[model samples]
Target: MSESLLRVVPTVPDWVPAQDAADAAALVVSAMCPGAGELVACRYAEVTFIDQGANFEAVGCPVCTAPLDGDWWQERMDDAYATRFATLDTVTPCCSATVSLNDLEYHWPAAFARFELQVRNPGRGWLSPDEAAQVSTVLGSTVRQVFSHY
Candidate 1:
């Protein structure tokens, strides 16, 4: 059976909050998603990719707004992976503009983060902007949510 995930990540890829902040944020998430089956707060030693899983649609150049080639994106991802995602900088295949992979416009809003808060099977849909802002305020960082089904 498919599982739905509500994944939240900080806007800054390398940012990880204090343990107390993470704990508080987890509690707030639990209260916000009361119907969720499981909630996990993860801290990574290095930045990690957070994808939208089966919800992925397409990626576009942030500069030109042209659709980026999947193969080309894969190559860049591979290169970034070589450094364990420490460097996301690349020249856009569409516009030749230097940009960070983190800046790419992912349709499903994938991201890189050293910290993640995940709610599995949240009975409700996406979080509203105000809810996100609340979480962000508690965590002391701007955050983005990614909805995933897999």
Candidate 2:
């Protein structure tokens, strides 16, 4: 019951933003499902506007990047999605037991700022909880900027 998320190769290049190697190609991972029609397409981010062999790419800021070690990657993977992204002081995972984007807030709920999520029955790509959170961040920022006049 996960959303259709996309999957891409996990590698970074000189032109791509190296924000946290872990996230270098995470979006591509999720895109696999969406592209294949597993999840509904709420938003889409194309990295570098170039489709490599198969997958697309996304660019993060330099500040988000860091030299990685196995331990750090595993630890971040273990940590709640929100915690890793926002460095939240507290975290709580949503076990709603169903795939529904209806609950997603227009604004980030302070409590789940750094939590992770797994979309169900992806028609296209698979967005891990943290990747989903980042998706929200991008969507929210874009929405606010575009509709500021409203």
The number of the candidate with the highest TM-score is 1
Write the residue-wise lDDT of candidate 1 on 15-55 in tens digits. Answer: 99988888998898889999899999988889998999999
> What TM-score, over all chains together, does every model reach?
0.97, 0.20
- lDDT of each residue in 1-150, candidate 2, tens digit only: 212222222121112223443342335335534534232222123211111121212211122232224343335334523333223122113321221111122121111111122223344323455654555443331110000000
Q: What CA RMSD would candidate 1 show? A: 0.8
Clashes of each: 0, 58
| Model 1 pairs whose backbones collide | none
**Candidate closest to the true structure, highest lDDT:** 1
Which runs in model 1 stand beyond 4 Å of their true positions? none
lDDT for model 2 comes to 0.27
Q: Which window of ten consecutive residues has the lowest lDDT sum in model 2? A: 141-150
